[model samples]
Target chain A: MGGSSGMTITTARLLRAVTLVVLLIFLFRPETFEPMLALLVANNAPAIYNQGSLLSLTISHLAIAIAATAAAALISVGFAILVTRDFGREFLPLSRSVANIGQTFPPVAVLALAVPIVGFGTKPTLIALFLYALLPIFENALTGLTGLAPTVREAARGVGMTGFQRLLRVELPLAFPVILTGIRLAFVISLGTATIGSTVAAPTLGEVIIAGLLSSNTAFVLQGGIIVAALAVLSYDGLTALERLTARRTGRVATAV
Target chain B: MIASPRHKVLPALDKLGVFIAIGLLATLGFAPLMVFRANRIVLGETVDIAQAMPPGPMVVLLASIGVAGVAALLKTSAMMRLIASLAAIAVLAWVVGVSASFLVEGADAVARASPASGFWLLFGIFALMATDALTRMDPKPSLRIGLVLLAGLALAAFLASGIWDDLSVMREYENRAGSFAREARRHLFLAFGSLFMAALAGIPLGILCHQVRAVRGPVLSVLNIMQTVPSIALFGLLIAPLSWLSTELPILRAIGVSGIGAAPAFIALFFYSLLPVVANTVTGLAGIPANVSEAATGMGMTERQRLFSVKLPLAFPVILTGIRIVLVQNIGLATIAALIGGGGFGVFVFQGVGQTAMDLVLLGALPTVTLAFAAAVIMDALVDIMRPSGVQKGSQ
Candidate 1:
């Protein structure tokens, strides 16, 4: 009876967390408010909802952000696995070197190199975001895997489980929490880097800022920057909530209530 | 660790593979030369082999082949050997062809040519070298080969372009070498200077925030807010305040300080660096075991003494790590400072893009990338040295 009640409590908490994230998303959707404000400021306020270009731009930016972040997560996890196996220790320094290179190479530089070949667009922007997000994802995955208690792994192996079986059933489940944290970090980074995409003619929130800069329009710049900041903050808060929910689900967090 | 007959046989095979790869590259590299020679006959123009050829790409290709071939020849699986050999051959050929064209035909020709061609050539070479190096017993040799190839490329460019004789900034403008050298030096200087200022301001503030709980929350939140603001907007925000300051203050105006230059640029970069340094410092200090501090206190050490001797010594490594992050971030952001006359490598990058001068952009960008990498390595080395032996032993 107590266990069932506890599960119900957890479910409610998870739902609340989801609601918060959704709220954040809606807040950053410029079509939801930006156009209405622009209209009101330009002249008299209209009662009708305006489905402006801002909606399409926001959707495309979000899609690019998600796709790039997902790709970064996969590559980082694979690299982390390679770093943890029998021959993995020997490659630790090499792995760190590569990850360091990825982080140290500025996204703008990547954009410059990519522009001539990939020719400007969301594709080049996606590549830059992926590379930019690699370090944190890779580091977190490696840290999570290595931080696992050896005894738990040994016990699983002792129970007649094959290495692969033990890895999937025991190690990965245990490491999921940390890996999720990495994903969260990568997601936030992708969101920020997507703005730089606007420079290469890839339409994103950065377009607004760049347009503002060129025209010296502080109102437009403020509108764009504020929306970007709102997006970053909201996304960060969403990730934190997700992290908390994951911890609770995984029985990693000790809740008083 | 002793080398056996197997090792000797492997190295020999690797050497043979390298030679074959280099040979292929040289042949491919000369393909464009052949095309140029044939075209000259049709146009009734004499083909000058010395003028028509670029040996740099060929040399780099040859070097790559030699290194990769030796790696393949080692007593490895047939699959490893085949990949290494093929990669070496492909890379060499591509490098030779591309570099030859780039040297003989020039920048405009390269730009007008197929976009995919140069990328594939460069990508193939980089990939092949990476694979060959990774498979080696000692990766150092492969890295050395890469460095040597880079050096050869640099030397070739210098010799071919006559850049050495006309190294003067004024001379470049007169000779149409463009503003590559002068712009590169300015950007490099800004990157280093911005990094230095960020460190000086950030570290002490980080330490203060770490020591005082009262200031930590507000300081951290402000820093976090600053980071979320995009670079362009941050630069824009500074113009108003800085312009106002210059107008009000006679001293600032007299020094040629304006809204759009170094002063505003530096402030923006420094602001951006605050969060990482402060957050890391607080986290590092907080992470120090409570028992250690208690023990120091029990020993009758003063608060300042305990902080300096015990807590700081223990937390120094993590603190350094945070500083490293701040320094690297500052370097990258400093480039964007050029948008507002911060006058770094970004000037060239933005200007090149604006003017469609890929060469000028590359000149601006490549060194910044190299400098950032070098800074990261130097910081990593410093962190390694400062780390206690106990921590090192435990991590391994």
Candidate 2:
């Protein structure tokens, strides 16, 4: 049984490697799959998107999602930490409600609203992404920090650890895996959402799909959809792996809330 | 550290309340309360709250907010804080409407007036403070539900009152009243219709997975992958296969199962809704204690009878939670359905974006947010109410 499970892991890794290679080929040399795409698209013309290289579009898409998720992580984690502490404990309900209510605003609506306030293009997209990504990370971080076992906390205190020292050295490490899961969810969400940023004239892969829709070209939409989906899936898998590794190291089973 | 008589003279302040009050004051003092636009599309010049309102009422309103702020800062009882915040919010709402009317008094018929940053910030700050007070007060669940209904009705009446007729959003609504109604219905159809389909399919699939353990892992993983596909991509991907089907089979086209419009959007939303419903159903069923199942069997209950009488009743709240999640999520996602010509509130959103008309964007966004929020609140209340009484402490 152990050997079979190990074999399954090997097969999974091999499948992942093949998927990565295919994704790279599709992004950099999409024409290699053109004959097949032509069969799917009904357009005899070049099935590959020509306005911008798929590689560049993928990079910009990753950049926007990464930058927004990073900023959201910093702010949300800091705010969560603050609210969990003694001085900021009064704000917990406010924080929880804010996070919950903010999420009820759809990502597309939020992005559209941002365009009017911040004006068009990448800034609005970034702002929307940052705001939309906030709730999960904040909620998860709060859960992780506050849900710590009382005995473990007391043990840290018994070791003569100061509040700050205990939080930094003990609580955070134990909570890291859960917090990472939140960041993972946030990142994947941002990656998917950043596609819509193209509507606001942000240079992202959604530009490809929207352009395709405008011209009734299936190839463009397919190209954009494939790359975006691949990136999201791959990144999600990588993050899940990282989460598992950290959970194992910390002697805690990471659970998604 | 000793309690001192001198300390009694000055009450310890509520820090968060003070922070929110400061935010309100700063917004009123600095930010523009409204914008006066010459027409629907152009960027408008901002009008300060004081400048936009008549002096007498403006001064009175400002004074009320100041009083509220002081009440917040003084560590007053929760009841006092709640009343103060509610009063302040009422004043702010009236002030905004009056200012909109004031700003548009002599402007051309085509000209528009809309609430600006100061108005939004003030309203948000006060509402937060009110909610905070309410949370601190910890009202009964029934009271909370009643308040939500009352607030919804008040908003409907407020809109119907025509006090906001001068606002740009109201102007947009006036122009598209017929289409707005159509789109609103379509949006509801897209959200609720897809949710209905998902529940129909998902509950059965969940039962299958729970009963046949062999299928559980594969089924969940596939659903997880479906979820990972970004919504836009999923919607986009559906177009090709669906369009081909519609073209290949004229009968499907007749039934309106096309690549674009509500069909793909419905299908995509249905797919998105499946994971939560199925997962929760499986969890809910599996979570039934083994002893309970044994007792049901010992009572001479058949498998079907055991499921209906014992297991499902216990799991209903959990399943409702999943439904709540799907409902809120579908409401939000329905906005994106408009991208595929699916026709929801997103039509106004994208059009407003294209035209650079902020009010039009607000026309779409505000409703979507409100609907999602209302759904969440109602669903949450339902979940709370439906929880089996014995499991109350364990559930939370």
Candidate 3:
């Protein structure tokens, strides 16, 4: 106990302190970061996000992310339900391959390929994000649904519930937590990947990162990195919390709970 | 949707099939099959290739229409569906050759000829018909492989026939073939080199994290935080530190560590690989059943012997899954490395974007997509073969 007390600087505490410092540098005084850049760079150029407020960049980033994730969720979940049904059973392998096509596609290639067809800005980024997010959501939804206890589904059928009714009332609720896990994975990953959207004029936090890259400015990179990292951690935690909460509420999802 | 007594095949979507058939017929009848151009990439006066080209390939067109019509019938034979799809694909290949034949003949007068919207829609309908037919037949893997090989052979025959010389995309490829090959090789080098470095660093780091309880939490959290940083930002962040290293340490600079180029790209990719490798390693090691280790010990194996012989062998496949993910991901991220003069296929993509040349973009994109897809399939097959039994599914 004495030895433990002697060293009060725990790793967790250090991590917390470092995180706080990073946040302060990102949000308040980015000037504090310039010195580190000056130390690292020969031509330490100051990088800017835009002439406008950084808050707008943050919002635009979040907006695109949320919109794309939401769209992906809607389509992926529907497709999952479709492929799992008796009529759509034959499409199961094809669906898996198609969803994987999104993952196999590099978002950079998707972005480059998109610009010619979709033009610039949020449209292309959203398309890329939508494609990038599909695999996780689809795979997870399939797992969640397919992994259901046969007895529970049998009970649902025995209870005279129609296919749609069982999906809505029994299967979906049971699968909700696993589906949320997929959403969480997709959301956090998208938070990082959406930065690339700024390259195609999507006006995300990547704008700062790209600018910093071009100009050799470490401070701008830190500013952008800090925000994105924080956003990822926060969203990851928040989604996890939501998952746990829903798992608890849906007593059927006993494993995660 | 009802299944007839003689129709032994699965329930077919006759409505959708018929709709697509009608669409295919309309496309062939009304829309110009392919457009001819007088200059490269310039939208010249549109001439319908089907109407203007000699020997028309009318027989193939009529065959495609007949196949589509038969497949759309209420109770078509599975054999008929297979023939329809194969015919549709054959027609697609033939149409491209026939369209390019005119441009090839008038190579001096015509600089380019491209498939217009009609061709695209027709292709889509044919592809839809093909997929529908495939789902019906559910052909064996060997049969599917044969079909793919046959299609590839046909396309190669077309290209070797020199009939597509006036196609704009091919023209772009012709100009950049030398640099394209070089860039493709360098792109591969960067991906493989980065993965090698990642394994070198990550595998041991993972072992350390797994063995050392004190380091596990901090190491994992740090890597997690590292992963959350966007690739662009991480690459940007590395430049300054890397440049500093080069400037401050002359010996390091002598080895070609620099502010830009492959050094920073490799560093960033290394960071990206860490989370998966380390996490999977930790998971794999911790997941080892207690009895398995006890049996090794009971057999008089030392700690090193147990780890090497028992734990590692048990864990290798799971750890391999992580490496597979990293390898595919690295192939993709290497494209961004080109932006920093790291020399990859990305040069063409970015240059195309700059020039607003879509064909140039395809020259880069098509290969990158193929590389990524091939890496994924090959790795999946490798993992399956290495297991020999069956994969541990949800655990991965």
Q: What DockQ, between 0 and 1, does each candidate earn?
A: 0.28, 0.50, 0.44
| Model 3 misplaced regions, further than 4 Å | A1-50, A252-257, B1-55, B61-94, B101-110, B114-163, B394-396
Clashing pairs for model 1 are B13-B73, B14-B69, B14-B70, B14-B73, B18-B69, B29-B96, B187-B345
What are the per-residue Cα lDDT tens digits for candidate 1 across B151-226? 4575466446643231111122243344556655566555556556766776678778878767776677667767
Best by lDDT: 2
| lDDT digits (tens) for residues B206-274 of candidate 3 | 888778877777677778778888888888878877887999999989999898887888889888988
Instruction: State the lDDT of candidate 2 residue by residue for B297-394, as single tens digits.
Output: 99999999998899888878888889998999999999888888999999999999999898999999999988998898788877878886775221
Candidate 2 is scored at a TM of 0.95
The superposed Cα distance between candidate 2 and the true structure at residue B356, in angstroms, equals 0.3
Q: lDDT values of the candidates? A: 0.63, 0.85, 0.76
Candidate 2, B352: how far from true, in Å? 0.3
Worst 10 residues of 3 chain A by lDDT: A1-10
Structure candidate 3, residue pairs in collision? none
Q: Pick the TM-score winner.
A: 2
After superposition on all C-alphas, the RMSD of every candidate to the true structure, in Å, is 8.3, 2.6, 5.1
Superposed Cα RMSD, model 3:
5.1
The number of residue pairs in model 3 that clash at the backbone is: 0
